[model samples]
Target: MTNATAERPLHSVSVAGIVVREDGRVLVIQRADNGAWEPPGGILERNERPEEGVRREVAEETGVTVEVERLTGVYKNLTLGVIALVFRCRPVGGEERLSDESTDVRWLTPEEVEQSMKEVFSVRVADALDAAAPHVRSHDGERLIAAA
Candidate 1:
């Protein structure tokens, strides 16, 4: 492999958790650096499994423990070469608190998410909320494109 190719992989795998409380509120976080509200997630570690990564990311960002239920959707940011596996999760324990990665954490209703987030990020929550079938989608980081 070329040095440049070795330095960066073709794409990166990330995991996101769509956590919902019994009250039907969804978890959302405002990023510390960007201040954009979205689900809790991050890059999967080298040796971590995707499900474990999802759990860890949610706990780290929102300070809530979760039980991952099932795969909800898969999203790709085509512009950034990021593939994110989103899972449906149920809150198990822990009180909400802000981490270094998050500036704010809130439990929002479905209507609130639609009003608060951009379409691309909001779809992730919508897919989970539907809880019907796994959605596979691609985006240019802001707008979603029809799946290929």
Candidate 2:
């Protein structure tokens, strides 16, 4: 491998699902670790596909089964070097329940999402809800930063 490519630090890849219901509510989880309200997701497995990771993460954290619709946004945590692939999904089955990763699970309206989640996370939901194009954004783990 080339020295430049081999020596660069590796970035962690995470997958998130914005599970929207027929009534336009979005599924969200209150994280047990930090008590932050965000969509259900986690680090992608080494060998897992992005869509599979989304379904697995959503199910694991929120106990909701989802069918991935499309990639809604690609976000990078500039400080953490985490690349998060956020997908827009539709709930197909399963019940809402809490897991070790989440203390609470609830479906919220779009307005509630904007009020509840941090800018970095809320923007992901907003982009998914917007029917334009998938967004590419960078954030400092919480707030969005200007594109470079």
CA lDDT scores, all candidates in order: 0.94, 0.96
Instruction: Report the lDDT tens digits of candidate 2 across residue range 1-148.
Output: 9999999998999999999999999999999999999999999999999999999999999889999999999999989999999999999999999999999999999999999999999999999999988999999997899976
User: Which residue pairs in candidate 1 have backbone atoms (N, alpha carbon, C) closer than 3 angstroms, thus clashing?
Assistant: none
What's the number of clashes in each of the models? 0, 0
Residue by residue across 62-95, what tens digits does model 1's lDDT show?
9999999999999999999999999999999998
> How many steric overlaps does candidate 2 have?
0
**Model 2 alpha-carbon miss at residue 111, Å:** 0.6
**Estimated TM-score per prediction?**
0.93, 0.95
- Worst 10-residue lDDT window, candidate 2: 139-148
- Quick one: best TM-score, which candidate? 2
After superposing candidate 2, which stretches have Cα over 4 Å from the reference?
Answer: 1-6
